[model samples]
Target: MDWDREARTGLPEAVFCAGKTPAQIDAILAEARAAGRRVLLTRLDPARRDALAAKEGLDYDAASATAILGGPAPARPGRIAIVTGGLADLPAATEALRTLAFCGFAGELVADVGVAGLWRLLERIDAIREVDVVIAVAGMEGAIFSVLAGLVTAPIIALPVSFGSGVSAGGRLALDAALGSCAPGLVAVNIDNGFGAAQAAIRMLSPRGGTAQNAGPS
Candidate 1:
């Protein structure tokens, strides 16, 4: 479980629940409890979440398929803005938001602002610009990532969502676009990896002194 990870890297170990059986998850949770640790669980589907419903202090969000054990830590010092290209991208954006919350950071969601309707994003530009970091979630051509990067001074973390048809299927098109973006200094994580994007933002916002308080939940 890498119990010292928060002390070593300013980031605690998180459990990825996908492909894990109920018994295995129970064991992991039991171990965490025994160690007096707080843990975040990602990719926990509704069925699996239901299976673990008896777990004490389990805070589950079905939309993002994420769960928190031992509750979230106190809020940290950082402002994050999660922008989605469209309503279809909300799941990925929600994951990022949940990750930030679990890590004791506050973030806001700016939804349905795809370039297809540029006015939507333009109207909300002011609010988004106020954040320390921006997470852009999009599918299809993923023009939103580049557009937001160009518009905002904050670091842009492109999170490609798997929501589209044809060439955009499986989020590959959006992933390629993010990787190939002409926007200077724009960074990208794996397709649909909202948790990774949140962690990256946390690292960017973490105190330079490497204090354990800034490290995510213990």
Candidate 2:
């Protein structure tokens, strides 16, 4: 596959591995790298990482149940801040940051500051305000988006993950929470889609955001 669309439009191709075999993963990786584009793989099982470590790079953060590929770290300008509900949400946030890096865009990761404690989010307002975009990863009520929308002027990317348990209504509670938000500028990608969120942010930050015309955002 021609993977240059990512670099061409400032959006990277994401390989979601929540349900793929090692062979499939390897094939995708080979194709992506062959096209001279960065390859970002997320949510791999522990054993899978070990199986592919020799051929593919890995940043194993066992606590987060995440396997990261920080390849090509997109050479982007401007800061993109990543905020998670708490330490529990690090895996997803790290995934977001990793995806950003793959597109050559480095970003800041802020965790353990859920809106439950308003003061925590308040303290980071100054720093959060400076980011060109904000990726809010939350679960179990996921009210973080509403609070963040009120706090920052930058475009907010609300990501609802399967962080909540059964009674927690899976991630729907979080999804509903974000959608219910009255924030005009706030937009959502998909469930636990940190890679997608990061990709969109870069597009907006690139070449004055959407003004690049049919030539593909110069």
- The lDDT of model 2 is 0.73
Structure candidate 2, residue pairs in collision? 73-101, 73-104, 74-103, 74-104, 74-105, 75-104, 86-112
**Model 1, span 1-218: residue lDDT tens:** 77778786777789999999988898899998888889999999998877873577888888999889888878888899999999999888998998899889888999999999999999999999999999999999999999999998999999999999999999999999999999999999999999999999999998774445445555
lDDT for every model? 0.90, 0.73
Local distance difference test, candidate 1: 0.90
Per-residue alpha-carbon lDDT of candidate 2 for residues 107-151, written as tens digits (9 for 90 to 100)? 898887897787888898899999888999898888888888988
List all candidate RMSDs to the true structure.
Answer: 2.8, 3.5
Models 1 onward score TM values of: 0.94, 0.83
Clashes of each: 0, 7
Clashing pairs in 1: none
Which window of 10 residues has the lowest lDDT sum in candidate 1? 209-218
